[model samples]
Target: MVAFSTDTSPLPKTKKSLQLGNYGTLMSSQEMPEEYWTPLKLPPEKRVTSSRSDLTSVATDNLSELLDETIAEEQTTIDRVFAFLGFTANPFSSYADDVCNNKASDMRLSMLSNISAAYNAVSISMALDIMQDLYETTSKDKSLCSSALIAGMIVGQLAGGAIGDILGRHMAMAVVMSLQIVGALITACAIQSSFSIYAFIAIWRLILGIGCGGVYPLAATITAESNDDTKDGGKAVALTFSMQGIGYLLPPILTALLARFVPLRLLWRIILGFGAIPGLWLMVLRLKNQIARTNSQVYKSKRNMLTNAREVPVNVLEAIYVEPDLFRKMIGTGGCWFLFDVLFYGNVLFQPIVLSAAFGQAETVQRGAIDSAVVSLLALPGYFASIIAMGHQSPRFIQSQGFLMMAILYGSIGVFFQHLSRHKFALVLLYGGTFFFSNYGPNATTYVLPSLTFSSSCRSTLNGICAACGKAGALIGSMVFVFAASKFGEDIVLLACAVVSLIGMVVTICCVSETVIHDEQIKKPEVRMRVVISEPSLLDYFETA
Candidate 1:
């Protein structure tokens, strides 16, 4: 036990105000009277029990005493605590008091920390549309667009993870968003000029991929840090991920609406350009809120680790190698995500082509119209279903069931596709049915599993890596599906996907634990405190006993 004696005779006090870095205020130290410093004393019986209480109580009592002394030394400490609590209560109001007041400023800072998460679903969905345009423009040149986009995604994810760790989430997001804005502008310009179209699209896509990839880790890190309750953090992350459906929905809707007014070639450009709008808004919010302070601890720790190491400091790659358990878990989850992305992206990207093949050669505009409506409608229910189902089921159970269902559905579709004729309503029903099951399984699981597998410290890095692997699968699917369809037929490609889906289902069931259920089962112990002293003071010691 630690002890300190309070001096009843007051020392000469300085009136100078104290400034706190987090709150951004100058507060007076003379608010509490000198009498508040009367020696904290307890009777002899209580002094004997202090050592036996739980560790948490001892720590809390020690902390309270430290706080009391600090308050006596500087009266503004209580004011700071009150300011902090106020900021914690309501974070989103934009009134001047809310922005400028110390508590409000802290709240706004926390809000900014999480803003990147808010836009992730939108960015990912927009990237898919951009890839679609690239494929459409280069019909004969499929690999160029697919390879470039996939490579961009991989590189961006790696860079984003690294930079996010080094620079802090806000700065990293700002840099990435700036790059995205530039990429969007360049991509839009490239649509107008066909010269070096492949190279131009490739470069822009790579840049945009980096920004998109960077935001995922940044958002994950921010959410982990800002959230006090782990369950709330999980739910918040789950909700953010659920927005991927929104991202998935946006491009097609935008394409459908704008394709009529704009040229098809220019339509994607406008859509891609629109991708920068959210990023720009995020940048502005980050600047206004000054989120750098919340991010400082992470940055400082990373800096010290790098500077103080006698040996070559372990980078993410090295860390993964060192921590094989984490690596395996990440890889397992990532593999499941990969399978999901392949099937999901393959189905989405090739729906028009598949419909056209199923229906036979038809008017291009008519085909586009029918395919667009079918894809759009099928997606809406799946998104809503995902949101509802995500909350009710454990990620492991949902993902496992989803993969099994997807496999069964895809297999059924493959068998039925051969019998269905072009323009038949049954074909649309079959296709839509398959689409609905796609979200039920892998699509929803990929997003939820990452939040569960890792601790808060490395959640973003692990999630980003998993997301990159999923993109890799999408890339492979993009290339393989086109080539396989041209050679073996779409039915064969889908049958293969069904097999892969089953493998994922088995893997998920066998390997992944249900995090939500498991976390709830592990109870945190409650702690109580007992403070003791040999002598009694004028005031009675207020013990919770």
Candidate 2:
């Protein structure tokens, strides 16, 4: 028979104070408080001598029984807690244990499903073509169309950014997707209506643009925050961005299909009406999966504090300005995007004119063939290269290098285009090179950089501001490209883009830092140093003592 020894011992009390000392300086004993120390009392017991073999067997049996009972109780407690929280206890409940054991295949599948669902609204290029038609029909004036489109872009980005902040990312995305559906319907109806169809289209486009802009920031924020690894976040974001390339590729194919099968006038209406399908589907999925995949955890703590507390909440502008370092970084990074937009959009908009001069303005199927083939082929390489680079390089590096390369390429075009004897193959090579490098650099940079730098809480707003700046740059670029081409020709306009690209390169080099690596350390020592130095009392003491 096994014998049990019953012993009673008092549990030790926790220490009330701790002493900390550096170098030879002695911290006060009173401050440390010796009274906090309570030694554990040993159990008073008389040992009964027994054979070693019997004692070992008895101890092992007792230890196994104790562990078994403890594990059972722990499992019972866990189940109760999970029940209270309304969470289903499944294999996924041990996500961390599974991850550690390299068994996260289900998690991976879930993430992929979420990504596919989120990125279903891939209609950017189709939307652009549809918008062009709306503007042309409504305004009958090219400049007004351009201006309205620019304004719409800016308004959409700013509103989207702000809305994403006020509401959660999921809510913002759902709202925008709903708006997109409405905008599409209104635009389709407005086209057929007799009353100022142009104004109606412009207004609807503005609403559509707002929704589109919101999607970018919200998607980026969600992708970055949801992933377990930063590298995974980058890959997820890159995949979403790759959809823009899909949109770019799809439209030309769509346009070609429409041209071959459908009438040109009906094409715009079909595109506009069809654009809502993806958005509506995404909205439904978002609603259905709201409980499982929402990014509420990211903002919940900050939001709870804001709601429960009496302290005044800082306005967006006030919060930004208060942190001057952050403000400068945002402005500088945003400025690079601004410059990138000018060069990128300017070149894209004026490509027809440049190609017309090189290949001759025939407006024939041959001309269309050459133009489509060249642009499509050039864009394909650039887009794929960007996706590949997203995983391997820092966004800042890609952006800065892209700007510098674009500046050089554009500047060279001015010098080289004049000398080339309008050889079709040679011109294609030059144009393709420009398109390839531009996508590789600025296009990828603009999208990637905004997603990387800002804190999750403020990312949407900052990205919105960056997007607004980008549109402003596009507006400037379009006006300049048109003006310069009219006054001096393509050479002058290309040269101007080169200068803007150079400025963009400079801004990126000076301001942006790599955000791919998670900086576990505080935001930068300089920011804190400046904060301390700026205090009046600190400055006064430094000057005197």
Clashing residue pairs in candidate 2, if any?
138-198, 156-210
Please write out the lDDT profile of model 2 over residues 347-442, one tens digit for every residue.
675577556756676353333544554566566677567656765777777777777777877777777767654666666666777777777777
Q: Pairing residues by index, what is the TM-score of model 2?
A: 0.65
| Model 2 per-residue lDDT at 149 | 47
Query: What stretches of model 2 exceed 4 Å from their correct place?
Result: 1-139, 142-146, 284-315, 322-324, 354-374, 515-520, 523-545
lDDT of 1 by residue, 1-545 (tens): 32222332342222221112222222222332333233223333333333423423543464456445654565455445433333222222222221123223223322332233223323333344445544544443444544655676577666776665444444555666666667766766764256556667666776766766665555555444444343344434444454555555555566666656776556656766776665565455545433452356553442332222111112544444443356457656888888787876547544765567566553543345445555666755664465456545676777788788778767876777677656467667767776676666567567656656654334556777887888788877777887888898878877887898898888887767765423233333322222221111111111110
- lDDT to native, each model: 0.54, 0.54
Cα lDDT, model 2, residue 45 = 34
Clashes of each: 2, 2
